[model samples]
Target chain A: MNVLIVLAHPERKSFNGGLVDVAVKQLEDAGHQVEVGDLYAEQFDPVEHAEQYPHSAVASDYFYPLNEQRAHYQQDTLPQDVQRELARLEWADLVIFQFPLWWHAQPAILKGWFDRVLVYGGRYTSRMRYDHGYFRGKRAMLSVTAGSPGIAFQPFGRAGDMVAWLWPMHASLYYVGFDVLPPQVSYGVQGGGIEYQKEDALRIHLNACKECWATRLAHWEREKPIPFAGWEDWNSEGVLCETSPWRWRLG
Target chain B: MNVLIVLAHPERKSFNGGLVDVAVKQLEDAGHQVEVGDLYAEQFDPVEHAEQYPHSAVASDYFYPLNEQRAHYQQDTLPQDVQRELARLEWADLVIFQFPLWWHAQPAILKGWFDRVLVYGGRYTSRMRYDHGYFRGKRAMLSVTAGSPGIAFQPFGRAGDMVAWLWPMHASLYYVGFDVLPPQVSYGVQGGGIEYQKEDALRIHLNACKECWATRLAHWEREKPIPFAGWEDWNSEGVLCETSPWRWRLG
Candidate 1:
């Protein structure tokens, strides 16, 4: 199997980066081809604007992101970095996002990855998203680190539910047709109550997380993807049907 | 009242910009002082890195974001843009985030604003978050535009719950002690089912949304802020207490 690990962190020696190294070694040892995309190392330009499109397809006066994206994609004139990411996605059977959760979500750099790399007309159209997404058969998962403890992120915890905070990302992955797996969250990565426990305690926790991640990857295929309501489960108005299991949560 | 509308859109002529214009006019007419922070126009760098902290108090080899933030803030040496934003926050009683929803959240530029501007030690400490956050008395709301129609973002709509998508952002604002109001979502800004209604229909819709927003702004002071669990509501481990009113949703 081919795998792509996208790392979004400023410091290469950070715990988030350490997890990427662990993933690479683990996946490679399992006889899989692995490539890591270190976003910070690449100096990825995150802001999407008129500047991203040097070859103008839209009017000089206006910049509609979707229109420009569609045009560039159709012309095969996308930016080099975007082209490289798309190529990686095309080659990978599974993709892993490695990052520290910031402000209850992925950092801005990773957020921009979804904005730029996923071309509209080429990657997803009105009919091409959800179960029919361009990368449907592929899989994606988030490996996140947080500053707060696991208890703080429990359901109704002070730090908020990890699942709820990650729902946008999970939903986006599902929208684009990846079989989304449940996230592997390494909580209390630094500071918070863990600091009172002692500084080296974080070091110990990091190693333990690395071991847990490796074990999970080896037996990953046995796990089922997290469930999501698909097209068939919704009515013409795009809402869940009466028989849909998702109703209980929404209600 | 002082209001700051931070806009994160590429095109100034876009509908998102139009909403900001409508807001400025409405709030100003109501005798409130208002300021607009055009992130794109300012060319705000979204990627936070070691370079952002020019005066490094940490060792040259390693860069920890929170540590650097705390050090720089202690020295009163935060990035100019961040300092400016912090000043704006200090002056404002209410803040409005105006942007089109990209991939179910704020655009990368706006997301970066939170990452960069919310200083670790100064803006929030482990003890100074959630209900006890620094900006507790201030109010914040998201004025968002979407490509999909309202029906598609219903409880279990295909576009997914708008509430779920914006949860991370809402939670972030709440963390920093802002009373997060329910978002003003102007759905179907373009494409999707709206385009079938003809391109000019989007124009009509934009105008109507502007009117609606202006009308709402007139009575905004009366609207109660969205409720979130406070510090008192949580136990020592940070989990919500059994008697808490928030338990119903968690269960």
Candidate 2:
């Protein structure tokens, strides 16, 4: 399998990067092709602006992102970085987003990847989304690190449910037709570990996390994609019909 | 009342910008002071990295974001931009985040604002978060614009729930001790207008939205903040206790 690990953390030596290294090693050992895209090292600009499209296809007076994205895509004048990221996505069978959970979601860099790389018309259109998405055959997953331990992210945990925090991104990936796997969360990953007081315990915890990631990646291909309702579930108004079978499992 | 509207849209002419204008006018007319922080115009660098902390509070070898944030904040050496944003938050009684919902959340610029401006140790400590947060008295709200129609964002909608999309951000705001208000969502605001079939209908809808926002702001002070679980609700391990009285409302 061709795997693209998109690393969004600023520091290359951070625990997030360590997980990426582990994933690479584990996947390569099994003879799978892997490529790591470091957003920070590559200086991926998270902000999307009019400057991104120098050759404005629409009227330059008012900057409309969607219209410009659609125009530039048709004109083949998209920013170089976005093109390259799209190429990586096209090549990968399974894509892993490795990042620290900053402010309850992916860092701005990765967030903007969805904003910029997933072009309006190119990636998704009026009909080319959800189950009928463009990259229907491709799979995506998030491998996240957080300062708080897993216990803190339970249903009623103080830090809030991590799964709920990740729902939007999951929905987005599903919108783009990628079968998104359940996130691999490495909890209590920070400078001095929130759950671990002693240095030795923190080190052990970190090592254990790496081992866990390695094991998970070994059988990643066999994992089922998280289920999401498709077009048939919804009525003409884009809301679930009363008889839709997935109503009970709704977000 | 001192109100700060932090806008993250790339175009000042966009519908999101129009909402900010409406907000400012409504507040100012009521003898309340208002400041519009145009993040895009200000060129707010959303990516938080080593460069944000030049004084080097922590060792430069391995960049630890929390450690650096703590040290820099303690030393009063935070980046000028962050300090400025903090000052704005400090001054405002009500903080309104005005942005188009890009990729199920705030745009990267606004997302980074949370990551960088809300210094980890400075803004929130272990004991000083949730109900005890530094900005406890200050109220914050999201004034969001989405391309999807209201119906598409209903419970079990084809576009997924808008409330669910906004939950992570809501939790983040609550984490920092701000009494987050229910978001003022202006649905179907985009270049071509998704819900409005005719051009005249789109214009009328937008005007109606502006009127609705103006009316809401006129009575904004009466709006109750969204209720979140306090420290009293959580047990020793930070999970909501069985008898917390807030379990049914849990995310």
Candidate 3:
């Protein structure tokens, strides 16, 4: 098995980095080849614009990211960084996104990964999305840390539902044909100032979080992907069919 | 009304740019003071790391972004760019985020805006968030454009729910006590290569979308904010009460 851990945290010494380290060790010990995409360390350009398309631009005047993505991808003239990331994705059987939740989502760098790496006409199209996506057999999961406690992320909590916050990411992964696994959330990650808790307690918590991540990765292959209603569940107008169980639950 | 439109698109001549222009003209025509934060034009550095805090470092060994943000904010030594943005936010009565939805959310530049500008301790703290955030009285709204059509973003649509995509952003704004208005999404925005539609038809569609946006801004003051559950709605554990209406609806 091949595992790609995309680490999006700034500081490599941060807890998020620690999680990636844990994953690499655990996955390697399990006889898997591990490749880590340390976004910050590589200085991954997060902004997707015309500048990325130095060659093979479909329209020179107006920059549509999707068109540029498709053109460059076909021409094999995509930016070196993007080509490298795509190569990594192509090599990986499973991908893990390790990052601290900033403003209830992944950091800009990781967000731009999806924007740039996931080429529209290549990775997905109108008909080639959802279950029929390009990377159908691959699996992906998010390993996120939040500054707020677990309780605050519960439904109707002050921090809002973690499930809801992760839905967009989960959906995107699913759209690209990856079997999306449930997220591993390290809640109440005392980020900068450890004023709230004792040093010993914080250390214990951090270690425990790392252990939990390691344990999860040990059995990742056996875990079931989160259920998402696919094309068959929806009607012609792209809404959930009246008879669909999701309509009753989600509507 | 003092309105700050933070434009996040790369190309200044793109549709997203036109939307900003339309917004400024409309808001100004309605006797509102408008400020456009063209992130790309200004070359705003979106990456927040140790480099952002050159002098104000609580701990030089580890880079904790929140701690640096709080420390720099208190010392009045925040990076010049951050300081300028904070000043704009402070001056604005209503904040408008203008961007193209790249990967089910705002562009990386805009995402970084939320990460950098919204100071952790200064803009929001555990106690001073939600209804009591630092920018309590200010109103913030998202004016987004999507390449997909409206039908594709319905509740069970192929594009996924627009509401879910915007939830993280909406919750983030609401967390900082901004009254988040319903997003103005111009769907089916035929981006760079408009081979599917004729030039005249594309022009008409673009103009209509601009007019719709302009019309909405004309009544900005009278617009009611989208309702979100408040602190009072949750229990000590931060979960919604069993008897709460949300529990019945969401659960």
User: Which one wins on DockQ?
Assistant: 2
**Clash pairs, model 1 backbone:** none
- Model 3 Cα lDDT, one tens digit per residue, A88-180: 999999999999999989998888888888987788888898898888999999999997788888776768889988888898999889999
lDDT per prediction?
Answer: 0.87, 0.89, 0.86
Better of 1 and 3 by lDDT: 1
lDDT of 2 by residue, B1-251 (tens): 99999999988877788888889998999999999999999999999899888768877666778889889999999999999999999999999999988889999989999989889889999998999988998899999998889989888778778878898899899988999989999998868432323587789889899899999999888889998889899999999899988887623
TM-scores of the candidates are 0.96, 0.97, 0.95
Give the per-residue Cα lDDT of candidate 2 at A48: 89
Rank ordering of all candidates by lDDT, starting from the highest: 2, 1, 3
Q: Per-residue lDDT of B1-251 in model 1, one digit per residue for the tens?
A: 99999999998878888889899999999999999999999999888899998778755667788888898999999999999999999999999999988888888999899999999999999889988899998999999999889998977688987888888899899999999988899988873222233568676887798899999999888888888888778888888898988888742
User: Across residues B145-209, which tens digit of lDDT does each residue of candidate 3 receive?
Assistant: 99877998987676888988899999899989999889999988866423334687777787888
Q: Model 2 chain A: which ten-residue window has the lowest total lDDT?
A: A190-199
For candidate 1, what is the DockQ-based docking class?
Answer: medium
Clashing pairs in 2: none
lDDT of 2 by residue, A1-251 (tens): 89999999878877888888899999999999999999999999988899998878986777888889999999888999999999999999999999999888999988998899999999999899999999999999999998888999988888888888889889899999999999999998868432333588888899999999999988998999999899888888898889988787723
Q: Which candidate order results from sorting by DockQ in descending order?
A: 2, 3, 1
lDDT tens digits by residue: candidate 1, A135-159:
9989999999998899988887888
Best by lDDT: 2
TM-score of the A chain in model 2: 0.96
